[model samples]
Target chain A: MIIAVASGKGGTGKTTVATSLALVLGNRAQILDCDVEEPNCHILLKPTILTTDTVNLPVPSVDLEKCSLCGKCGEVCQFSAIVLIGKTILTFPELCHGCGSCSILCPEKAIREIPRNIGVIETGFVKDLDFVQGRIRIGEAMSPPLIREVKTKINRDKIAILDSPPGASCPVITTVKNTDFVIMVTEPTPFGLNDLEIAVEAIKGLRIPMGIVINRSDIGDSSARDFCNNNGLPLLMEIPHHRKVAEGYAQGAPLIESMPGYGHKFKKLSDDIQMIISESYEGASI
Target chain B: MKIAVTSTGKTIESAMDPRFGRAPYILIVDDNCNLIEAIDNSANVNAFRGAGIQAAKAIADRKVDMLLTGRCGPNAFTTLEAAGVKVGIEQSGTVREAVERVKKNEVSIADKPNAEAHW
Candidate 1:
């Protein structure tokens, strides 16, 4: 089963929950960190990477010789990545989505796709647990493609956990899509509650089974809990605000490793998720 | 020479919009500073993405010789420059005043984009 850990607001402990769950699962789980922009799971897991592969997007390269600058490529390109200016045809690889529309629709067959490196995917292991992550190059605007690349490494034999990026935008959607369940990590602040509402809507739209894990559960107003209760969403687990957890996190230690007995809590969290999924399946059949 | 000025409304009295891509209107004028027309740019303004490029294409399709706006992003600037359109940056005041300034050569032509992409 693939479970995605996501949070609408940043710093809501997505990596914390995801990494801890992986630790509890041990050899039975493989974690794919799909937060390509600012992947932080590596900070805690610190898996010794066994292999690394560069990820590239195919962008169009024009052949000036066979080309008639009919401007059709430019006209078809929605990104304005390719444009015709007088007799000059310019292609901006950064803006290209690698859709191959320009090359496919070119009348003269003058456009050829060339690979442009956007990021890298690294595969490693933390003891018996398999780990994989994608690191997007700095200044790169898009992360969905890289996130998709990381998902390709999913191991079906083991429980797969995906650490998703913040916000309910395209990157977050890409990471959470096709997962068995989504665990939304959130704090108790108003901003957290507002963004969580947006995220809940997005997940509901995808028709996925989801539960909330309120991080720092005791600090803020009871509105987050109230919102979940009114919506009939399950409150999976709560990690209280504690200085030891904070210091351990700052020192790049997994909560399960630093907090001693916290591994049992994460194991319980995974068991609850499994129970919810099986119950939903039974409900759907009935 | 026909010039386009990003505007907030469909009249010469409209304030010059600082934004090029999301501008509501494009006030067109001739060399004599006469009001030609104000083209509604609401379509590009409401676009999900690529507003800057779409707006640039819209203005370029009008065959305008120059563009007057507060800022031009890199993508829009490249498209405008490629189409041989001169850009006047940091433009403010009413549409008519901007046109008068352009005619008097009081606006500085942008050699490179003043803002990053998606600005």
Candidate 2:
């Protein structure tokens, strides 16, 4: 099963949980950190990277010689990437979505797609756990395309544990779209609850089954539990606020790897997730 | 100086400004607070990332030493700081009014609660 760990806000320990899960799963699982802007999974797992690939987005290159004054390309582009003046076609490569409709409809066929480097995808192995992630260029406007490129590393034979970017925006959606299941990590604060509600709405809209994993569970209020109970979603796991875990994270050691006992808990979560998925499928089959 | 403006409507007139709602254009007065040249910042509405570089470029292109108007995000704020521009905050007025406010030192910069699009 493809399980994504996501949150609606930043700094909620999504990477910690994801990396721990991947480490425990070992050869049985793969991990994809789709948080291109600020990926932190690699920081903990310290995988031996085998190969790296750069991701490129398509941008329009306008050929001025054959271009006419026709504005159809600009009109069809929802992003306003192309603009046709009296005799010049002004193109904004940054805003272009590379829909390719402009080049297809151009009377003079003056527009061509060019490779615009956006980010890089890195892949490697830490023991039996496979890892892949995307890192977007600092100044690039688009990120969904690069996130998609990174996900192509997913191996179907093994379980894919996806560490997703924060929030319910396009990047988060791009990371979690069509995954088999989602494990959302949140805290017990008013801010966390508010964002969790937004995440719940999005998960419902996408028709994806999800469970809650409350981080810093010991310190926060029980509002997260109340919400999960009311919504009929399972409380998958609760990771207490521990100082050693923080130290472990800072020292670049996977929590489950450093503390052998914690590995059992992660294995249990993985098993429980599979059980939940199987129950849902059996119910549907009946 | 050229400035970065973040309004919805196109051009200098008939604008649906996100910053001031009805103003034709609102350059971030004292753009050092933000580091953009033009007040036409579209990062909040259209972009997923890279707001600082793009917005700062628009204003920096105009040789702006200060950024003026409305909220500032950490990403944009840090980029401007590195570029040696000052950030001034809390602006809601016509672009002309903002320019005058900066000249009079009436506007002050503060961190916005969210990343972008205050309205």
Candidate 3:
């Protein structure tokens, strides 16, 4: 089963939960870090470098010689990446979505797509656990493309845990879209609750079964927990704010490594997710 | 020479819109400070991305020789420069006043964009 660990707010322990789950599952799991903008899963898992693939986005390259400055290319482009001004057809490669609309709609056939290096995906192993991560080229506006590249590394035979980026926007959606279950790591704070609600709304539209994991559960107000209760979303785990765990995390230690007691709990969490998915399937059929 | 002043209103008497990409109106004026045309730029104000490039294209479409605005971003500056539009940045007050200042050679043409992209 493919499971994604996400948080609407940043620094909410998504990497912690995701890496820990991979550690507990050992050889049975593969963790794919889809947070291309700033992937942190490798920091926790410390996977050995095996293979590296450079990912590129195909942006339009206009051939002005055979070109008709018919303004067709500009008209077809929705992002305003290419515009025909006066006698010149200007192409802003960074703004291009790589949709190929401009190239496909050109009557003169003057536009051809050229690859622009956007990011790189690295795949390796942490002992028996398979690890993959996407690192977007700095200053690249788009992350969904690179996130898609990261998801392509998901291995079906093992439990794939995707460590998603923060926020309920395109990147997060790209990460959690087709996953079997999503574990939303959050805190009890209002900021956490607010973003979590937005994220839940986004994921709900995707029709994926998701649960909540409240980190630093002992400190902040119970609003995040309250939100889950009112929304009928299951509260999967609550990890209290402990100095040892924080210290261990600061040292790049996985939650299971820092606190071995939580390893069994994460194993149980995985089992619970299986139960939830199965129950949902049964409900859908009925 | 035809000059385009980024304006908040259609008339030349309106206050200068500080933003280049999200400006509501771009009033085209002559060297004599006469309002020739007003290009509505409301569409770019709500654009999610590439607003500056779209607005630059709009300005260039009008065949303006110069642009008088409060600030010009890198993308808009590059597009305007390509279209042979001399940009006068950090010009405030009424659109007519800005045009008059440009005609008087009081406002220096910007050699580089004053603001960063998306500013």
List, for all models, the DockQ compared with the true complex: 0.44, 0.05, 0.77
Badly placed stretches (over 4 Å) of model 3 are: none
Q: A-chain TM-score in candidate 2?
A: 0.96
- DockQ, cand. 2: 0.05
Error (Å) of candidate 1 at residue A276 is 2.0
TM-score of chain B of each: 0.94, 0.58, 0.95
Off by over 4 Å in 1: B9-15, B34-38, B59-63, B94-96
On lDDT, who's better, 2 or 3? 3
Error of 3 at A264 (Å): 1.2
In model 1, what is the error at residue A229, expressed in angstroms?
2.8
Task: Compare candidates 1 and 2 on TM-score and give the better one.
Answer: 1
Q: Count the backbone clashes (under 3 Å) in each candidate.
A: 0, 34, 0
* Ten residues in sequence with the least summed lDDT for candidate 1 chain A: A79-88
Error of 1 at A79 (Å): 2.0
How much lDDT does each candidate structure score?
0.91, 0.73, 0.91
Report the C-alpha lDDT of model 2 over A189-260, residue by residue, as the tens digit.
Answer: 888888988987887788778999998888768888999999999999988888888788789888786666
**lDDT digits (tens) for residues A1-286 of candidate 3:** 8999999999999999999998999999999989888889988888998999999999988898978789999888888889898888888888888999999999999999999999999999999999899999998889999999888888899999999999999999998999999999999998999989999999999999999999999987989989988999999999999998999999999999889899899999999999999999899999
How large an RMSD does model 1 have?
Answer: 2.4
